[model samples]
Every structure is written in C-alpha cells, then in structure tokens.
Target: MQIRDLPYADPGVPDVRSGTRFLLWLGRQQLGGQVKCLLWGLLHHLGIAGLPLGVGLAVQAVVDRDGGRLALAGVLLLALGAAIAAGDVMLHRTAVTNWITAAARVQQLLSRKTAELGSVLTRRVAAGEVVAVSTGDVERIGWFVEALSRFAAAAVTLVVICVGLVVYQPALGVVVAAGIPVLALAVLPLLPHAARRADVQREKAGKATELASDTVAGLRVLRGIGGEELFLGRYRAASQEVRRAAVHSARMWALIAAIQVVLPGLLLIAVVAYGTKLALDGRIEVGELVTVYSAVALTHHALRNFEEIAQAFSFSRPSAKRAARVLSLTRTTTTVPKPREVEAGGDLYDPLTGLRAPAGLFTAVVCGDPDVAGRLADRLGGHPTEPDADHTSVLLGGVPLDELPLEDARTVVLVQDKEPVLLSGTLRELLDVPTSGKVRAEHALAAAQCDDVLDALAQASVATGGDPMLTRITERGRSLSGGQRQRLALARSLFADPEVLVLDEPTSAVDAHTEAAVATWIAELRRTRTTVVLTSSPLVLDRAHCVVLVHEGQAVAVGSHRGLLATEPRYRAVVTRETDEELATADGRAVELDALEGESA
Candidate 1:
C-alpha cells in the first residue's frame, strides 16, 4: 500500500507463533512491493557484475588494435553504466516504499490492539514495552523486511559471478569461489554473542523508557510528596544501565563489522596473488586476470550484504517476537453469533454476585471492599473478570450479555470507573462521544456539576481568545485539578446516556457538597433509565431508590437507605462508619419515626 492510502483497508491477520513466521507473513502481505524491490535490486547488482566483463573485453580489443571491437566494448560499458544508475535509483525508491509500508502495517495492528484492549492492555503489557514496540521495534522489523530483497539479489549476483569466473579461468575461479563462502560465514561464530548483547541492551532500554514515562506521569504527585529527587536519581541510574548495555552490544557488532571487512579483504588479496601467478605462468591472459580481479572485488560487496542480512535478522528477531506477542493476545471471551437489535433499558443482573439493578431504577451497591465493588461493576457491564468467565454471565432483558455483540453490549451498558481518562482535545471534541443523543452536552455537564469546570475553561479560552468549547485540554486533563477531571469524565459519561449506566465511585474525588449535588442531579437525570452506582458514600447511597449491601463477595442485604440503617448492621457501617452512640441514635431515629408514622395510621 502507498503511504497516502495508509491505515490499510484490512491489516490481515498475522502469524504470531514465532518471529520468523511473523516476518514471513509481512513479506506475503506486501508481495508485490517485495517482488519489485527484488527485480530492481537484481538489475542493479547484475549491472555492476557486467562492468568487469566490459572492461576485460575492452582491454583485449585495445591490445589487438581492433578499433571496431573497442568501440563496441565502449558502447557496452556505457549501457551497463546507465543501467546501473537507473537500477540504483529505482531500487532505492522501492526499498523505501517497502520499509514504510511494513512499518505502517505494524503500527496499524498495534493501534487496533490498543483500541480493542483499552486499559486492560497496560495490565497485560508494560506501558514502556508497548511504546518501544510501536516505535523502535516497528522500525527494526521494517528494516529487516526491506533488507531481504537486497540480500536475495546479492546472493544471486554472487552465484552468477562465481559461475562466470569458473568458465573464464577455472583454477583461480575455484580458489575465489571457495573463499567466498568462508568469507561470508566467518562471522557466524560471533552472531550468537552479538544477539545476546543486543537483547540485553533492548531490555535495559525498555526499562529506562518505562521509568521515564512513569516518572513523567506521576511528576505532580512526586513533587507534592517531595520525592522528585528520588525518582530523578532512579531514572539516572536506569539511563546509565541502558548506556552500559548499549555499549556492550555495540562492541560485539563492531567486532563483527571488523571481521566483515577483514575477511573480504583477505579474499580479494588471495584472488589477486593467485591470479597474478597464473598470468605470469601463461596459464591465464592479462585481460582474464584483470576480469577475475574485478569480479573478486565485486564479490566482496556481495559478501558484505550477507553480513548485513545476519545483523538485521539478529536485531529484528526480538522486535518481531515482541510484536507477535502483542498480536497474539486474543480476547479470551467467546464471541457469540450476532443477533438482531434488542430494546434498550434492560434490567442488568450479574449471576456471579447475585446483584441486580432493576430496570429504570437507581440502584446503589455498597461493598466493604472497593475492589469487589469494582469487579461487580465490570460484570454488570458484560465485561467478564476473566476470559473464561463466560459461564458467569450478566443478563440484560433476560438475554445473556455475553451473547450480544460488543458494540450492542456497550450501547446497553456503559461503565464509568473511578479513574476515567480524558483524552487531549477540545471541550467539544471530548464531549462528542458515541451516544444515544437523548442527553444534550449542556444538560449532562450541569447534571455532573461541571459548571465550575466550564467556567474555568471559558475563562482560560477567553484569555487565549478562543471559544469555550474549543478550549484545548492537556493530556489526560493533567492541567485540571483531580476533581475537575473527574467531573469532566462524569459529564462525558452522562452525555452518552446509554440504556444502563454503571458508575463506580463517580463522586469519590469531589467534596461532600459537590458529591451531594452530583448525586441529586444524577438521580434526576437518569430517573427514566437504569443506573447502578457502586459507592459507600452516604450522600450517593441515600439518594438511590434501593441499596444493596455486598459483603464477602455476595449481596447480603437489600433495602432503602432508612430501612437498611434500621435493619442491616453491615450496610449502616459501610455507609455511615459511625461510633456506637451515633449508630444507636441514627438507627433509633429511623425505627422510631417508622413506628410513630405507623401508630398515626
């Protein structure tokens, strides 16, 4: 594919079993490009091989004083030179196209995987390793892919030259031909050591990159805690280790390069010394000796190509393996057959936890442990805790959620976790998420209590002379306060207005007053739709139509805020966290009020 046509129509499935298979798969994907590269490379190298024959013929014609033959040889030399120049230009163009296309394909695969896995991707792979694979590892893979065609052409050209040498002068040709294999294979013994060093260097570099990324991401927290110098020192140590590993890797490669040069030079010397003896003894003509000598020099160039192929393979193998590892990660959940569209606003139920959010109700789940609450929230949205957790399914409107297509499932239930990400973009761009369009941006923002955030953004925009909606947000909204970012994310989720909304600790980052306001507005806003909030906050829980108290991974009690306070001790402790006297007063008041109202009736 051309650079402009990128983001391929389909980045076909790859073979991820091994690095070698992945590289071969890439070759097959860009077969046409590879073929063109090989053809042009062959033409270029063949043209260079022809030069010696032209010069040899010219020398013979000159010695015989045949002007006509000399002129013919001159024409042949000119044609070969022109062919070499043309082939060189085209070969370079095709090779570059191959390189860019390969890298683009790998990048596309990485991007698709990232989108599919979402936050779970970082849990499975290190953030730094992903970055390294997408950037440097991709280039290494492309380099090896593009180098393959040239290596093939070089091998073919070497063989042709050897055969011609043998036909022209057998004794010297045999010596040169035999030496060529030794020269090419001389560096094989050092490759294992070189590759091991390269792997070490790559590992160190990934760690250093990950360290830098983590440090930058948490720079604000570090500075607040007076730990900036500690992190900086750690990063310095990682950088130094990376440098040491790189130096060791480079030393091994440098030794291989020296061998590459020395072995070819020795082969050339052997050819020349042996050819000279043949010429002096009248066993070979002067022109033939010159021809053999030129061929040997050209053969050295071919041998260098062999060394480059070996080096490229050594470096790219690990990169390709890393890429394959990422590509091989398929979703563990079984993909069910697609069904017709189902109605929205269904009752969400998780069989594993036996927690149910009835249709069009505001249900609050209070768990003693936050992690258990989070897991329940995930299951409520048809997101299985494990890939093999299909047997435990969440049902929507009596249909097993795992049976629904991913997109349909998302439309039915949207889960907003505690730490939702806000991508860098304008305010409008951020709010322009996939939605049912029932809730307007203004209404959603107001419901999420983001008026202050909007006012801040508007003032900043005014100072910068831009529209409030067009105000640019920094990465992850880092420039905004924690509460501001949280509110913005909540606003975005509210704007989606899905059939079922599962919010996990949505108001944890806000103050009590703001939390109360958000709790009130959210109930009012989602009154017509099903909403499940996983929280232990009294304000949010009190506002829910019903509260389910989850204890030890199971829903132990379900009732209203007042009823739960009077009945379930666990629920009261989770929501109020009060002392014995305070708990007695609250529970007595709730029970006495209920009894007094009952007596009046």
Candidate 2:
C-alpha cells in the first residue's frame, strides 16, 4: 500500500500480549515499508563506503603520474558521489515514511481499542499512562522501528568495507577490522544503566503529566477548597522528580556517547600512526595507507549505529510496554458483548436498581448522589458499573443489553455522558456521525438552545462562508464557555437520534433559562422514543412523564415530580436541600448582600 494510504482501513487486531511482542507486531504490520527502508539505507551506506576507495585510488593514480588512470579515478569519484547523494535522499525519505506510517497505524489501533472499551478503559488504565501511550510512546516505538532498518544497513556496510579493505591490504585491514568490534562493544556495559535511567525518567514524566492534567481539570475546585497550593506543590514535586530523572538518564547516555567518540578516535589514531609507518618503510604504498586510514575513519559512522539502535530500544521498549498495557484493558466491569441485535421498542430496565423506563416515554431519574445517578445511567446503556458488585446487565426488550453486539447495542441506546467531549473540528464534523436520519442537525441545534452558540461561533470565525456549522472549534471546545460546550455536545447527541437515548445530567452546565428550554424541547423531541434522563433539576423532572427517585442504590419511589415532592419527604429534602422558610431566608440574605454592595458602590 502507498504511504498516503496509511492508518489502514482496519489497523487489524493488535497483539497486546507483551510490550516486545507488540513492537514486533507493529514491525510485522509494516514489513513492506521496513524492507524499502532497509534496501535504500544499504545502498546509501554502500555508496558512502565506496567514496573512500575512490579517493584512495585517485591518490594512487596521481602518485603514479598515469594520466588515463587519474582521469578514470575522477570519473569514478563523480559517479560514486552522485550515487551517494541520491541514495541518501531516498534512504531518509523511506525511513521517515516508515516512521510516520507506523505511528499512524498505532494511533489508529489505540483509538479503536479506546472506542471498544469506553469507560472501562479509564477504570483500568491510569490517565497518565494512556496519555503517555497516545503521545510520546507512539513516537518512541516508531523511532525504534525506523532505527532498526538503518542499523542493519550500517552493520552490512561496515562488514562489506572491512572485507574489501582486507583483500586490498591484509596487514592494515586486519588491524582495522579488529578495532571495529572493540568500538562497537566498548559501550555495552553502560547500556543497562542507561536503559534503567531512561525508564525511570519516562515513568516520572508520565506521573508529572498526569498530575498536571488533574490539577488543570479541577483547578477551580481546588481553589474553592483552598487546596490549590497543595496540588500545585504536588505537581511541582513531581515535575522536579521528572527533571532529576531526565538529567540522570541524560548523564548515562552522554557517558556512552563519550565512550563512542573517544574509542573511535583512539582506533583512528592507532590506524593512522601505524599506516604512516608502513608507508615510510615501503611496506605499503601511500594510496593504500590513505585508503586504510579513510576506511577505519568511516567505520566509526557504522559503529555509532550500534549505540543509536541500542538507545532507541531502551526508550521504546518501555513505551511499547505502556501502550500494550493500555490496549490490554478489558471490560472487567461488564460482561462480553454477544454478536446479535437488541430487539427494538422494549422497556429499558435495570434489574439491579429495579428501575424501569416504559417504552416510548420520557423518564427522569433523581438520585441525590451524582455517583449513583451516573452508575445508573451507565447500567442503562450497558456500560461499566460498580466493579465490586456482580450487577446484572440491564435489559432491553427482555434481552440483556450487554449481550448485543457493540454496534447494535450502541445503535439502540446512546448515553450522553455528563461531560461529553467536543473534539477539535468543524461543527459539521463534530455533529456528523452515524445517525438514524430522524433528526436533522439544524433541528438538534435548535432544540438544544444552541442558537447563541452558533452565532458566537460564526462571529468567532467568519472564514467558513459564514456558516456556523463550518466554524472551527479548538480541542475540547476550550475556546467556548462551559454552557456553550455543553450545548454543542447535547446537539451532537440529539442529532444521533438513537432508539433509546440515555442522558446523564445533560443540561447541568447550562443556565436556568437554557435548561428549561432544553428540558421542554427534549420532552417534545423524544416524545415517541424511549428516553431516560438522570437529573434532579426541578425544571427537567417536572417535564418527565415519570420520575424515579433512587435512594441507597435502589429505586425507592416512582411518580410524577409534583406528586413525589408533595408526598415523599426524603425525596423533597434531597432534591430541594432546604425547607420553605430556610429557602426564603437564603433569598433574603442574598438580597441584603446585594443591597450592601449597592450602598458601597
């Protein structure tokens, strides 16, 4: 396949048995690219090796005063130079191609695995590890793969040049050949230490990255709870640890590099001194002495490849291990999916919680604990639930929801998570998914009260022919406000228009007016579909056809919002958080504070 056709239509199932196996699997997948790289690299190095021979021949031709031979030497030099240049260019191009395509293939595989695991991935793998795998680890793995082919080429070039030298001049050739092994093996002792230090550095870096992300995600909460400094201190300490580990790792690698340099220089000096004595004593010709010197000098380049490949493996091995570990994550919190379709038009029932949403109706679930509500929502959609509990799978039309094929189950029910992500793309790209063709994008945007968001997006970027859908958004919608991002996510979910829609606190981030508008539109939009909303907002609950109150992990009450409020004391206190007098007193305090601020102004 062409390099442009990379990231294969199917990346194929990866072998996540172990890190080394995974790396080998990646290499096997790109065998064709690797071969091209190896071929071009060998040609490039061979061409380079030929240059020293041509120079030696030219020197000999000049010494002999043979005009025709001298001219032949010049022509050979020109031809070899040209070959070297062309080979170098093609070699680099192919190697980089292999690197990029391999990385892309791994990225595609990670994305596919993530899509399969969903929430189960986060539960099983650390956030930092995933970040490291998706970002730095991918590059490291590709680097190793790219280096492998070049290293092979360098090794072959060194051997071929040594053999040629030996046939031309046995005495010097043997000396140079003997030293090549020493230069290659001199740094072997330091490799284990360097690898260990690098692994430590990588581990420290991953931890720091995870800590930084967590701090940023909850910066507001941290400040509110007066723990910002605590987290900042922790991140700072983690950063310091990473820095120290990196410095120590660099020192070890630098020592190996010094050894590579000093040993090769020593070998070159010995070869040159010995060759000079041979030339002066009439044991070898001037040109032969020069050839021997240049050949030994050239072997230094090949020797460096050994070190390069060794270091590449040291770094990439751990990276591959982390990536493989992430890919190995299974849905331990849920049962395996069955390869069958879920029957349509069935009640969404969670047996563990004894909560049932009748077919083709808007059902609202209220749980004081957001965690409980979230778990319930996940159970409704056949997602990971409490790992400690052996929760029975939710049922859809009398069939286990988790038993259906992944696509079939997802087609039947889409759970709009509490914090739906907005990947960077044009608005159209974000909303354009495998939809049911019932609800249009425009209608979804309108229903979600995203008109302001659209206008803001258009005004933010008019370059897309003034089309809001064509407007560009930054990653995670960082440029937009929380409510705006939330609305856009809701619009995307609505556009899918699944047979059964389960939204967990969909409108929580929105303003009261927007929430009220969205709640009303949602009731109208999915009036005929089996829609379940987990929310405690009075605005959303009042609009539901039925509201189920969950307490201590079970459905304790089921009725209309008004009826439950009027009759259920526990539900009323949990939802309202205050009695009538206390609520009035809180309002009075808010008014008094406002008046005091007005007087101060």
Candidate 3:
C-alpha cells in the first residue's frame, strides 16, 4: 500500500497497532504498484536464476562434444546475459519506488502527528527525538518496505534453483539441499544479538540527540547563569556515551557480517566436495555438478538479503515505537463540541468548577503555584483534554466552554502568556499577531502602553518586504529587551480584543511605573469586556474588580484585593513585600553605599 493511503486520523494520538494497520491498509491502496513490483522483481530474479542453467547446458553440450549443440549453447548464453541485464535494471527501479513511497507515507504520518499535538509535542517528547524519527526512522522503515519485494524474489529464486538442482542430478542435488538449510539457519542465532545492539544504539542516539537539543535551546540561559561550560561538559559526556553505544552496535554487526561470509564459503566448500565425489563415482555428470555448484554460489547473495532485512527491521521497530509514543498523547482537558457564539458581551463561567470571571470586569487570579494558573489559562482557552476531571471550564454567558468549536473558542478567548512568542518578522508583524488587519493596531497598542515600543520600532526602521527600515526580529524576539518584548506581546493580545482576555503575568518584565500604567489602562480599556489577569504584582492586582486567591491549586478566597489583604495572611504577606519594595524605592535616601564603594576604591 502506498504511504499516501495510510490512515492518519488524530496524528498525535499514535496507536502502534493502528499505525501497523494503517501501513497494511496503505498496501491495499496501491495494490497495483505492489503487484507490478512483485511481478517485476520475480521476473528479474528468475531471469538471473536462468543464467546458471544456461551455463550448465553449455557445459553439458561441450562435455558431449557436439559442435551444433555448442553453437546453440552460445546463443542461449547470449540471451541469458541480456535477460539478466534487463532484470537487474527493472529490479533496482521497482525496489527504489517501493522505498520512496514507504518513506513518503511515514513522513506524512509524522507531519500529521506534529500538527495534531502542536505545542504539547515538545512538552512530551524532545525536539531531537522528533528529528531522529524523521530522518533515521523513516529511512529504516522504507528499507523494510523495499526489502519485502526483494525478499519475495529471493525466496522464489531459491526455490527455482533448489528444484533445478534436484531435477538435474539427484546426487549433487542432495548436497545442495543439505547445505541450503545450514546457510539459512546459521544466521538466526546471531540475529537476536544484532537486533538487541541495534535497538540499544538507536535509543542512545535519541537520548544524545535530545540532550543536544535541550542544551542548544537553553544555551542563552546557561550563558546568562555562567553554566555554559558545565552544560557543555555534560553534553560531551552524553556524546561519549553515544559513541560507546555505536561502537558496541557496530561490533555486533561486524560479527554478523563475518559469519555471513564464513558460513557461505563453508557451504560452497561442502557442496563442491560432495559434488566432486559424486561425479568421480559416476553418480552425477561433471556438467550437472558445475550447475549445482554455481546455484549454491549464487544463493549466497540471496541469503545475505535475509540478514539485511533482519538488521533493517531491528532499526525500524524502535523508530515506529518512538513515533507512536508521540502520537498517543490525548488532551487530558476536555471541552464541549460546537461552542455557541456568545452575545459579544457576557461573563465567562466555568460551570464544573463553579468559577466565574464576571463580565466586563477586570478579574484577577492569584495562584500560589503559577503552573496551576498556566494550566487554568490553557483550559480556559479550550485546549483539548479529558472530560472526567473535577474542573469545570470558564464559560461565556450561559453556554458551556466545551461546546465551542476549537477555532471559535480561540477567537472569543485570547490567552496572552507571560513570555509570548515573537515570531521572526517586522515589528509591525509582531504588533499585528494573528493579524488579519481586523483590529485597529493603534488602539490596542495605546491600551497596552506600547507607545515606546512603537517608537523604537519606527526608530529602528522595522518594516516588511525590502525596506531596510524593517528590522527582522530574531527568533523569539531576542534582539529586543525583555521589557520591550513583553510590551509587544501585550500589544498583540490587545489587538485580538476577544470577548474574554486571559493575561498571564503580562507586565512582569516591565518596570513598576510601566506596570502600573498598563494595569490602569487595561482596566479602563477593557471596562466593557471580560478580562482575567493571572499575576502576583500588586500594581496589577490592586486594579482588578475581583481577586481570587488560589492556595494549593484551588480558589479558597474570592474578594477584592483589599478585602483579601484584610482577611488572608498569605495574601497580606505577599502584598506587604511588594508594598515594602515600593516604599524603599520611594524613600530616595542612600546609606553611603556608593561612599563606602568610593572609599574602598
């Protein structure tokens, strides 16, 4: 079956049984191609199998010393040579087609799975593991697929030669028959070890690859913390371990190769010895002996294919497993199918959890563990997950959150992360995220207090197309300062202007003055729509209409920030620290800190 026909529903939720079934199903999709390849492979190999017979016939004619027969034999040899040449070409071409198609199908499945899992894919599997699957894994899978037809051809050729040998001379045929099983069975014992080593090698390689990817991704952070050398040392250790695994794997394969060569040679020796004895005893003719020996010699090539198929299968199985593991992740958070359109202005409610973000009000979420807040944000946006959880989702108006279609849910509920991604593009593009130019970019920019960011963009000449003024944003907007990136991200979210906005630490990177400005402006601008901010910043929290204090991952107190300060000691302490910081900064008096430094200098 062609890879294109393979079923790939729910790409991220990989079912290995289903994956195998899909591959089998794909074979059915391209029955015609498979049939053609099989036929061509058989014909090609059979033609090659005929060469030895033709040579034997010529030898027989020469032994009988008939001139007319010799001429016929020469003609037969010429024809056999031509057939073998043609068969070789067809065989190679069909095998390559099989390989390419199989690899293409696997690639399609991998691509589909990547899309289905989205960001969750990186959380579950390493980026390097994905890379390994795409490159080494697909190739190994293709090898097994291409090996199928070649294997069939080899089997057919083996049968034809064995039959021909038996029919031509029973005495020589007995020896050929006995040696054939030995040649085939001798490699079996070694296969398990080889397969084991190959599996281990692939695993080690994947780990090393994952380590490298993580190291590179965190290189900036490592450098900032003076841990680059330490990480590099760890990576070097990982590389060495991978090297050791590779050498061990190679050693096993080398042994297998040595065995394949030695056993075949021994079989040929036994065949020749038995044939010569039978020929001297007049039980087999010299010409028949030659044909039997030649068949046995040629069969070695076919037997080697068995070894290759085994090796390829060993490599491919683990890759398939890895790919399958990635595809198996189902969203644990559940949402309703077909979410109803809200009245454009209403409260967002989570009926299951009895949590509500009041409509047209600035609601603040205070979770002790920020991760829980992040997860809630993910669920609030209606990402996929299980339905059985205790969590009821935030809904709009009276409708359940789960009822919304994925696209509509995202459209109505925009979740701006603390560290929003700034894709590579002009500053204009960064400001206009998910931009269809629907929202007035200037209004959103103003609300998010992004005037300075805009000024910097204009000053830096950031534009799209060939304009040198348009500065290309480095990956993740690393070229910009942390505060600039944060404000730009905030601007993008504001531009979306969904019915409900979920902001997670949106102003964490900005200075206190900027944070207070943004918080006040957001509260003013989003007065007519629902806004939920997940943060611990007092500047932002003080402006919220309602503040929910979450402890141990559950909302235990719901009140205004001031009310919470009066009632909750934990909340009081957190806020008091911030108040102290503000007071300290405001005091302006220096305690001879610079004077002491000057004296020391």
How would you encode candidate 3's per-residue C-alpha lDDT over 298-355 as one tens digit per residue? 7877787777877776777777677666655543355346546666777776554446
Against the correct fold, how does model 3 do in TM-score? 0.81
Off by over 4 Å in 2: 61-72, 118-131, 211-241, 273-285, 330-338, 351-354, 385-392, 424-430, 440-446, 449-481, 510-517, 549-573, 576-601
> In model 3, where is the ten-residue run with the lowest total lDDT?
6-15
- Error of model 3, residue 284, in angstroms: 3.4
Candidate 1 runs further than 4 Å off: 335-341, 385-391, 463-466, 578-601
Which regions of candidate 3 fall more than 4 Å away from where they truly are? 1-14, 17-36, 62-101, 333-347, 351-353, 359-362, 384-416, 423-437, 441-470, 495-500, 520-530, 543-545, 566-568, 575-601
lDDT for predicted candidate 2 compared with the true structure: 0.86
Put the candidates in TM-score order, highest first.
1, 2, 3
Per-residue error for 540 in candidate 1, Å, reads: 0.8
Query: Model 2 residue 469 lDDT?
Result: 79
What lDDT is obtained when candidate 3 is compared to the true structure?
A: 0.73
